[model samples]
Target: MKKLFTPFMLGSYRLTHRVVMPPLTRMRAGTDGVASPLAATYYSQRATEGGLIIAEASQISQQGQGYPHTPGIYTQNQIAGWKIVTEAVKSQGAIFFLQLWHVGRISHSSFQKDGALPVAPSAIQPAGNAFTSTGQRVSFETPRALELNEIQQIVDDYRRAAENAKQAGFHGIEIHAANGYLLQQFLEDKTNHRNDRYGGSIENRARLLFEVLDAVLEVWPNDRVGVRLSPFNDVGDISDSDPLELYTHVIKVLSARGIGYLHLIEPQVRSGLVEDMNHEAPPSVATLFRPHFSGPLIVSGGFDADTTEQALAAGTADLVAFGRAFIANPDLPKRLELGAPLNVPDKSTIYGGAERGYTDYPRIDEIGVNTSE
Candidate 1:
């Protein structure tokens, strides 16, 4: 049996354990998409926690951004800023990967360039709104359909971003093809209603995603590159006529690319409702996707200690990523090892807040070094 705590050699990185901190979007960077000193402090504090650290989804271009303050990788200042984060994580002896992101239709005009409506594969608008810097919620604007020329530009943006990530002293990358983003929008039949080569059948629908991956890999080795996918997630009103066929083809194409890993955000919702009425034995994506994807798998979404151990024990996943747990407990691996009580995350400062909730989480030192004699 492969223990979750056992050491593993993934690509060129030697991880101390199998527990990976999945990419989590805190939206805490400053408005310029510059990495904050608080972010450096936050990751540095959690450095001793085992395995790899996949950094949050970073915008590849200004047009790729949907949120007010998420970090970007295109400009010089952004790369220099992210260097601080990579240096901090490396100092703690953990490998970090930059997650490249492009939020397609999940944006308001206020978040777009010159208040222009965001662009997507189709002219569809998502069912949600975005929070601006002023903390005001605005409905998502209808996205402009992408032209072939514009599509080429977007692909170039990802390539440039990948090269920038390498220059920023980061190890590897995970393309943001999950969570109803640009690549995901391109993959979904409903969101991508183009008649061009970029849409239609499964092969055409997946062209955009594969192209972006190829671009990123041009700057990064397959051993150092990973792609994140959420096949059946209905977020942003995304769906496909044949999810299994589309995903299997996508995975098969990716498998031969010699990519390092594939991280899948498991299906927790189906068509705006909790899956299978939120029943005892809900549908698991591992059953649907595990057979087709023939590479290292990292599964995320609502996994507990026993559940993660069971998945690894049964070979359901190569690694299990915990999102909220890593936020509240910087020493989450140590807590899980000792079965210690987890610090409940404070929802107040979860997004765009000061360092109170970001880097102020208590570690085992504060709890164990009690001098209450």
Candidate 2:
């Protein structure tokens, strides 16, 4: 636990602690996908000098959006909106990275342009429900297979979004290649059934990710960029027949590219394990891939102060990302250091809400408890 507070050099910046705030999507953006000023306050409240905060996933383009009010980086208004957020976080001496995202098949027609089918590596319908723009939960529709030309367009959009992120004053950028999004759809065998250059073998399946990385690199240096991958997440009904082989290749390539770090989500930490778990936790993907990756690794999934210290001490993870914990405790690092009582998060107001649950959580100093009670 003591080591978690020690400063370490990550790329060119020295992070004050290893506790990171991972991207947690709070759908409070406007209908036009512009970030609200509340987004600024939300991030600033949790800001720590020399810590890292990966902002919520922002769609690369209108076609890439899967939910309503999820911010986008493709427009001027969105960029201006993000400028406010980045400025607010930076003023507090925290570094913020924008997660570039595209929700490939985990979407419905209601969010699509002109009722066009959502695009993916194949025309398969994932087994899940998507929150439509109208706030209705509808079954995911079978996404249309992305044409080769369309794929190039999406890549271009990512490239442009990277530039926009830079203009918006972000310290770095994170490529969102996990969670069954567009990049993951192209990486996994079950979702990616295309026989084109972007499918088939592991190399081909991972082609889109590397291509997107290449585009992203045109604007930002390799060391100023990071990539997040979830090899064990099945949230979007995403599965890879050969996750090890696929991720190993992807990690090696990204390492060679000199990216700042690799963010991996551990399986034990997903949202629904308690109710559905039949046995002990599975092997951590971080431990499995640690030797394969030469860069910094940030692992996320239910982690306490003890587990986080253990992972850092064992050299399995460079940092620990806290999502749910950070939701209820804006001063998470401080609270962890003091071993103070934390505010339990309210699940109901996690998404698409106001300050009721977003920024209303009381900090330790503000918790007015009667010590004599």
Return the top candidate by TM-score. Answer: 2
lDDT tens digits by residue: candidate 2, 1-373: 3888988788988999988999988889999999988999999999999999999999998889988788999999999999999999999999899999999887678878898889999999988687688888887888899988888899899999999999999988999998778899899998999998998999899888999999999999888899999886665777877777888898888888889999998766554211222123357888988888888999998889888888999999998999999999999988887777778989888888888899899987788643332
Note each model's CA RMSD in angstroms: 3.1, 2.5
lDDT of 2 at 198: 91
Runs of candidate 1 with Cα error greater than 4 angstroms are: 269-282, 369-373
Worst 10 residues of 1 by lDDT: 271-280
TM-score of candidate 1 to 2 decimals = 0.93
lDDT of 1: 0.81
lDDT per residue for candidate 1 within 1-373, as digits (tens), equals 3377877677877777777888877878888899887889888777764469899889998888877778899899999999998998888888889999998887667767788878999998777666554557877678899988889899999999999999999888999897788999999888999999998888999998888888887899898999998877777667777787888899878877768988888777332111222222226777567777677888887888888888888877888888888989998877776667889888776667778888888887787833332
TM-score of 2: 0.96
Error of 2 at 66 (Å): 0.8
Clashing pairs in 1: none
Deviation of model 2 at 347, angstroms = 0.4
